[model samples]
Target: MKRIPQCDNTLGPLDFSKMHTVLVDVDVFNCGAGPIPQDGRDVWHNDFVKMPFSLSSYMKTGYTKQTNTVRWEVIYKQLRSLSKKTTASVKDLEDAIIKYNPKYKGQWSFDALSSLVKADPNGSNYSPKLFQKIAELALRLPELVKKAVPLLKRGHPAAITLSQTQIACLLANAFFCTYPHRNFSGPKAEYHNYPSINFTSLFGNASSRKKQKLRAIMHYFQEVTAKKLTGLVTFERRCLKETDLPNWRSSNKKMHKLHVASYGTIENEGKGMLQVDFASSWIGGGVLGSGLVQEEILFIINPELIVSRLFTEKLGDKECLIVTGSQQFSNYSGFGDTFEWKDPHEERLNRDEWARLQRQIVAIDALPFKHRSEQYNMNDVTRELNKAYCGFKGHQSNEPDIATGNWGCGAFNGDKQLKAVIQLMAAAQAKRGLAFFTFEDESLKQGLQQTYHLLVTERTTVDKLYSLLQNYCATQQAYGSAHVDLFELIRINFSPSKSLL
Candidate 1:
């Protein structure tokens, strides 16, 4: 066997401070040419205002009749003021709960459940345990909501509160995990690491204080405060930083979006401002499901006006203009014309573009592993590999290759490039402090690592493109001499090396 080339690792430290700040801003575009709504309120149609609140409240209740009654009556009245709107059916609610928890669907009646809800005006008769169970079961409502009005409605406080609170919980978990670990000393022994709740520890124990322990843990998280067992070390004060853009500073602004444009207007009492959007829908609040990917810890900053025209643009009530953010802001305000605005939805990448971008994403994924490797010069390999991957889509076919001439996109050598992309992803996850290798659920990471090694054995840096030719030649040479299939030589060679020696 030939010696494998050793990997190199070396790189300058990356500055992350610039990526730490983020801002969130939002504006609603008007569908009609009218004065913008004040106080950031978007007007929903009648269907939105009249969603079935009473039924939703009923769904929140468990077997208890009394508790469901009061809640039902309150929501029914609220629902009456607006035109009828469809809400999630009782069956849908049940399914949502089952999906959320993967348990508790078998314990209840769906038809009788509705009957109990209709019969009772209040859920007061239910015990705290029942109420708690209902709360747990109803946790999935937020995920099912299609519109924002019902989420913001006053009557459905439980769903609204749960939705908001769940979002908060998710954000809080992310924040907590971002911080460095701590040191602790206890009766059992000294320990070091982030303070984490051991769900198994609580679940496995059969002690009498189990309920009390659970409550205590919940209270700690709710309060965002640490409690000490021996009155010595605090557990909660150290949480994730509340910074807006911790990762953006290290990333390219060209790649990271500050805002996406969509159409709408901002109007006050008499005057209206119009904006043409090039980006799609945007929320001023921080984006969820970011930071889960490589080379970025995503968060929403205040939105920017990608394109806008003032109120007096003489645009027809139905027409809109889309502009780029680089355009001057003063161009938007005018006097008598009603104009509609829409962000550039057309700019969103098509399927082929997305696939190409996926290659870049994979490249970004490899960066963290590169930085963490024991090899120093290998760091350049990581960055250059990522840069090449990200740049591949924008490159003309005639451009020189970064790794090899055959390494261009969609070439036969693409399999090797794709393998590199996978390797980079594993490296990035490792850099994010995740346990990539040991985690069974991270199949992407595992598969990438396996494929890289396979390619390594099948080919080499020295052989590069001609490794296949070399292997085929060696096999054909044996066949030409013996006039037997290639397998016979391999079988004879494998039959006891010690006896042959």
Candidate 2:
């Protein structure tokens, strides 16, 4: 199917050179970081994050009583045993992981893993050798990533760049649930601020979603172990400083160029553009859980992105995560309940100078509302706008445009036209263009095109649009539970001449 993108831009593709990445121009790999030093944040042996090789003394495992046996020793003994095997059953893998992580022995379930192994659609491609290969990779955690990974904690802006080999190693560790002190949660917990790192959550609660998710995840391990993967992936958590947050009520910036269409997806049509991940505040959302939404599905296809769950903390409304160079491993056929792992994705995207895949994704969670009326308030409106702006803001000159559509509109209950305007305002504020995919909603595609045409035709600026939203909010309040279409409001107010859309 040919994608006929609705082109509002009269110009051709702009040169994407000279765009700044989170990494510095230096080849140091960890370049361009703020307070963080040349070596990445090393919190090994600390309570914040317990690495596989952290000394038993540092980890303070109670087992140190007998001739100084540490936690990692027991972990490696079990993992080493698994690695020696040419093949293993799902039950064998579960038993090995339980030997190290005995705390969750009864708490966790491997029904999902077993189910995948039994009915895995990949047939021979998904075999027990893949599990043994994963164990071999998991045992190399201490070597593949020497630098201590700092948690992309809330509010602190930082970036981590690691080779795909390094990513594979870390994910391999995650697959085995080897990382310590990360399983706990809540206010008093050490890694309470971070997302779940272990694959324990994924292995439980057997369902169709988990089966499909495992297919993609297992495919990733198969590919990484089958070949010596090259390239790098960088995860940068961007925070909107109080000074950086735009005063939407005062700004006069006009709408940027928009290419709207009903077909294509952010990953396809928005390639080479800053792709948007309609994320949850807790980062990867429900990818580890039963969720199979847009965000979860995105993480499923690009399993490397799932690695961010290991170190990234919950995202604040003012913060967003920009991932560069992560490779996509599988193709899928549907969204949500209908999602199925189609096949392996031939990752042909060009690599950047840093040897990272050129693909970039921004994770920004929107305000989830129980009722659509909750979003009309100016305070919530400003929060969503600022959130998108934090992700859309340019780090350097000649940055690529944003590729997104219907963000926060599906399960979050966001009004389509309103979110569209909010994103348009953010892109304009960030000085980038936008490519919006309506995902086959012809009504939304037609409505959005008409509304955008009116906004552009009237030469409306961001500040002016913001003020109009305020008016619409008030009108919505006065009208009570009755819903109002934002495009209708914009058209009625801006289209004084009754221009045909």
Candidate 3:
């Protein structure tokens, strides 16, 4: 047998201070002009924005049960009134938001905003003047959406392309809580399946965590409002048909390139490659709620993605969101509860044929297990294989290898070994290499290398591994304590001396 190429397994922590930082100072209005070429309309989805929320749609002066009372004219007046001020207090911003969301007057808190201001009296992140600037930018929401295309919930594949500056305008509106009827959640709610879009949650919760979140968001507004964003970004929601799915248990493909590392995040280390966002089926997960993990961290760093919440519907098992060219506005430190905004990141990736950046990200939500044993069910296993394959499969032959690690293992409580195998199988079928980031798990790095070496040496096909998993799962179900490690199971069944000989 030929020697298989060893996977890259280097490990280390990301150094944020080393990242390049650029000064933001572009003419936002001039750049907002439609960069769409004459053929740009051809790529737009026909039935996009099934439920359109135009600038004029929610505008109303008097209160009505059916329509929003927070009129656009009223919002414009309040924001415009504050535009001339050199600085505005947290109370000033809160008052403006309350005027629009009268229903949540007493319910909402602004302790976080107050704390941010107190934390750094002289810091630009909490500057009172910056609040006024963002408020001024938020007022431009009317103009930004004036000629903007609707992003409808169509049954077929569709895409929406817009400039980063235009996205900033929409996000500014989100920051001010302008989108009506988006705060609620339930089965019958209009956007029940979507993550929350409003920034009210981040503003109210006064804590070390919320303060860090505020820093990231504030930095995003400062950059967009100050500079002329110069690139295009596309949000594509792909729905995979049953025919498109690979038959995992019957596959004959060998393992693609494998890299196991214990340090560095997929985003920084995997640059120029296809990155995976461990997302919720609903997309952003609890980004606007309280859930912060891999998915939330990705969104906060690239705030432009948050706009997808305005229109993207919940994804099915065979579906995924491929975001191309979204810009990263801020640098962040820590993970989950300890996440904090560090500094700015200047994106330097070359542009693609579509005028977007070369960066590509696929969002694939993993199954959340109530009990660890529930994941052992073959039905669930197959579902995960299909989901990962749906995201890893390349639309173009030139697509880069996938960069992922411990997907669905964190908040979802998935077993890392099982998920690693699942992703490897899916990537093999897709014919793409895998760069797995164990995120400082040294044991995983060594175990994965040994297990993969065995699989390569014995020429173990996907079907054979699938069968092995079946027995392992059965044993797990029948005798819980008799549960065997995956690598150990493979060793016992196909020891190198016996299986290879």
Best by lDDT: 2
Off-target runs (Cα >4 Å) in candidate 1 are 1-421, 425-436, 439-501
Question: Against the hidden true structure, what lDDT does model 3 obtain?
Answer: 0.74
Between candidates 1 and 2, the TM-score winner: 2
lDDT of 1: 0.22
Best by TM-score: 2
**TM-score against truth, every candidate:** 0.20, 0.90, 0.87
Ranking of all predicted structures according to TM-score, beginning with the best and ending with the worst = 2, 3, 1
| lDDT for position 30 in model 1 | 20
Worst 10 residues of 1 by lDDT: 229-238
Better of 2 and 3 by TM-score: 2
Candidate 1 structure quality by residue, lDDT tens digits, 334-422: 21122111111121211111011000111111222222211123233333333333322211222211111112111111222233332
Q: How would the candidate models be sorted by lDDT, starting from the highest? A: 2, 3, 1
2 or 3, greater by lDDT: 2
Whole-model Cα lDDT per candidate?
0.22, 0.81, 0.74
Q: How many residue pairs in model 3 have overlapping backbones?
A: 8
Scanning candidate 2 in windows of ten residues, the lowest lDDT window is 12-21
